[model samples]
Target: MTFKKINENEQQNIHDRSCMILVNFNSKELAAIKTVSGFAGIRDRIAVTSKNGNTKIKDILDGNMVDDNEDVWSEKAIIFNNIPTNRVTGFLDGLKKMKIRRPLTAMVTEVSIDWKLNTLIYNLKEERKAIAKGQFVDHK
Candidate 1:
């Protein structure tokens, strides 16, 4: 078996690395994500949400989501961790080129990494509602 070598900079726990967590994506959408990620040379950085949909964000960011059986969720979402802005832009552009439906997306933040998956998704939906009503405020 061939093992990949990681440098000193990558010696930190998995949370330090870039990751993209997909939640509730159908087979076609999951395939698209894999294709786009591979094209971006970040295929190893992709993950999927756990079947229970209650995994901690930090754990998800650490590539710890492991559900052997396929599960379903009402709304599809994507969460990104530690990815550079340019690469995120490129990934989104790639998705557009593939003609995939847009998924609710968010970047991991210091405050959000500790939240559970369901909690984060709830907040994101609320934020979207606020924005739709022109009541959204940027706290950052």
Candidate 2:
């Protein structure tokens, strides 16, 4: 097997990377999450916040909920607060596991939320964010 050459940045990132607090929802997604929850290293690597019906936005945002070792890509990962992390990661996992029979597509959006086309953005801070259901048509 040929050895792959890793750049310095890539090597540094790998050393710094850690487990994540993943969130998910929906039928297929929920199933995958349940599986991951039983992992022996679950507590050390991943945190599941949306297993129950009470998946709150703040729970993912709260630094206290996640371990310091879970900061994989960035410092603090505060920007991920807008994501419905449970649904996205879980859904993707279901796709990989071939358990979700429903057809899915890459609905491009930065934030994961059940969205309406005519939705209003009351928060100027949040206006830059995108909705999960969006196809990115005419989206800025």
Candidate 3:
């Protein structure tokens, strides 16, 4: 996975491609927002707006933030499905090719398995309720 510096325009692109939200842990309300959005998985974009505001996406599979700076706080707007595997590899390759200075915390909004899990949970809850109330159960 590779991290790239994105401007507001790029941020908008990310937002357009997938569901996302701004994540700020420094403030209580923002943190709660993060929690809810994360649970929903509908918003894959995460913007960590606190501290230096410098952010980058971390590659959970690779276990790296994809940036070089460590002081900058990870204020990111995640793009869940924006970066595909090939694109991710290409990004890393581009960084190596250009010898660009990687940012501190990498920002990624790629869709995660959690999204499906959440959906499944929601479905199960609805189904359980239906069964409990005998709405869909066989009455005969």
* lDDT (Cα atoms) of all candidates against the true structure: 0.66, 0.29, 0.35
TM-score of each: 0.74, 0.24, 0.24
Q: Stretches of candidate 1 above 4 Å error?
A: 1-14, 63-73, 137-140
CA error at residue 87 for candidate 2, angstroms: 19
lDDT of 3: 0.35
Tens digit of lDDT per residue, candidate 2, span 47-101? 3421221332233333324323222221111112222335335544554576543
Maximum-TM-score candidate: 1
RMSD over all Cα atoms, model 1: 9.4
Winner on TM-score (1 vs 3):
1
Sort by lDDT, top down from the best? 1, 3, 2
* TM-score result, candidate 3: 0.24
**Residue-wise C-alpha lDDT for candidate 1, range 52-132, written one tens digit per residue:** 456778876655764643434577787767666666667877888998877777777676778777777777777766767
**lDDT by residue (tens digit), candidate 3, 44-127:** 444433331222222322222223333443322233334344343444344445553322222233433223222222333444
Q: Indicate whether candidate 1 or candidate 3 has the larger lDDT.
A: 1
The local lDDT score (0 to 100) that residue 130 gets in candidate 1 is 70
